[model samples]
Target: MENGNKRLAVLVGCNYPNTPHELNGCINDVLAMRDVLVKRFGFDHSHIELLTDAPGSLVMPTGANIKKALDQMLKKAEPGDVLFFQYSGHGTRIPSAKPGHPFRQDEAIVPCDFNLITDVDFRQLVNCLPKGASFTILSDSCHSGGLIDKEKEQIGPSSVTNDGTLQQSCSPKTIPFESILQHLTSQTNINTSDIGTHLLELFGADASHKFHLHPNELDLSESLKTDEGILLSGCQANETSADMNPMMTGGKAYGAFSNAVQMVLKDHLGSLSNKEVVLLARKSLEAGGFAQHPCLYCTDENADAPFLWQPQGSDL
Candidate 1:
């Protein structure tokens, strides 16, 4: 399974256009990631698939479209291939289906069409990969630390902060949940039909649907104990990721966590391990006056693996 193979990637970014929850920098975040993957990671331009909310784009970052893109990326995966999935968007939580989860809320990524993809959905995707193919995931959104439902955490913040929010950003002008609802409401044409659908799916959908509640029935730990997939999350499940004006570049907006990752990668040039990336990104965020901390989720052995490990591959 370790034979030489090419690289593939899927990148998604959403800025919730013309809505109350509009973010300014997600598209820019994805563009930055594309740059690093092309210039530094040895990925060919033809092999990368980008889905964003930018104008004149062929693909949009809706739930169905995102799932389809991921399926395409995984369908052709092979041994020694470098597979990557990157998301720079809003992340939220809904009521957990399991009583075992203390917070009673399951983490999800906010897509353009409001089909909210959950952690279980991502875990299912990770499970589909072959043993020798390295699948690396980077999520630059709030509450994304647990997007791969049952993945082991090697570095993270305290789970005790489970109020489904960040105390630092709970100001009167920035209530994220309220903003999310307002954005969803804007999509409804006349009646409250869209919101009703969201409520129905959140409260009444069958377990087979992707938007269903936390149906984490699989033993992801044992299944992926030695798997090569790794996740670098923007924050803990209870925190918020910031979309600040890019003071460093001073033009477009960018997610703090995404910018930090690119910064670390540029500085280290593949010398850092997965845990080192998280720690360095944490320090970078703190230095930039951000409250959220980056996190790393992988098995113990993979924690020491290179940031985006590839079989028999070396980097600059």
Candidate 2:
């Protein structure tokens, strides 16, 4: 018995308020993506939840709150259901915990309260989806290239074509790196080391110890291993996503990668394959003057699957 008819989305964005890591565009990015799900995609308004750091939002984008929201989203999921998750925030790399994993680091999404959500955590959440269902996640953050470890590398900084051969290789970025570049270029009182130290202070000494406190050390592990999940990341494991100011939005801000994704879907009608979307978003971001690259991660056979593809029970 499958329930392929329902479409559910959980959108999370965090702009740490009054904090040194405060960002201006993350919340805006989620809002725009949410609108796309409601208008262009088939996701219903009722089934969509917005979790952000904005004051008085229905739910805050804390680690615990986010986990709780995902639990709720998975409550009624069944085979053939389509699940969508969009996260626009800061991403970091720390030590790896996988069995026999060689790397000293793994990728994680930074929650509002400084509680880090590691790649292992995401793997668990992904496994919760019904066997026939699909979990599609878009992570717009730094060091986000391999957020779901051990997933196939379909389209990355180095692309894998339908024949499984490498095609083009490019740069990495942030929903993950935008603010990083912004700070580096703005001539502000902050430097990379300064910000790194600030993160230590903000997130506390325990988080620093758990993560080994080695910020920006990205490692891609093939050793560790999940559900039928597709990941669209803003940049490579070493690169950061751009949190850019929207030129047309009158001082408003948005994530560089998220904005590119929105442009690709908004300008085109109907659906596009995963490869197509990643390619288009790359072109759009490059044209817009952002160096951060986007990548797609899925099984080799699913490389050509449509973005946010509706689950077909028979295929499972």
**Whose TM-score is greatest here?**
1
Among residues 3 or more apart in sequence or in different chains, the pairs in candidate 1 whose N, CA or C atoms overlap within 3 Å are: none
Q: For model 1, what is the alpha-carbon lDDT of residue 234?
A: 90
Off by over 4 Å in 2: 1-3, 99-103, 159-226, 246-249, 310-316
Find the candidate with the highest lDDT and give its number.
Answer: 1
Q: Which stretches of candidate 1 lie over 4 Å from their true place?
A: 1-4, 99-103, 158-225, 246-250, 310-316
- How accurate locally is residue 69 in candidate 2, as Cα lDDT from 0 to 100? 81
Model 2: per-residue Cα lDDT over 109-185, one tens digit each = 88886566767556666767777887788999888887875677877774422222111221222233344434433
| Ten contiguous residues with the weakest lDDT in model 1 | 166-175
lDDT of 2: 0.70
Clashes per candidate (backbone, < 3 Å): 0, 17
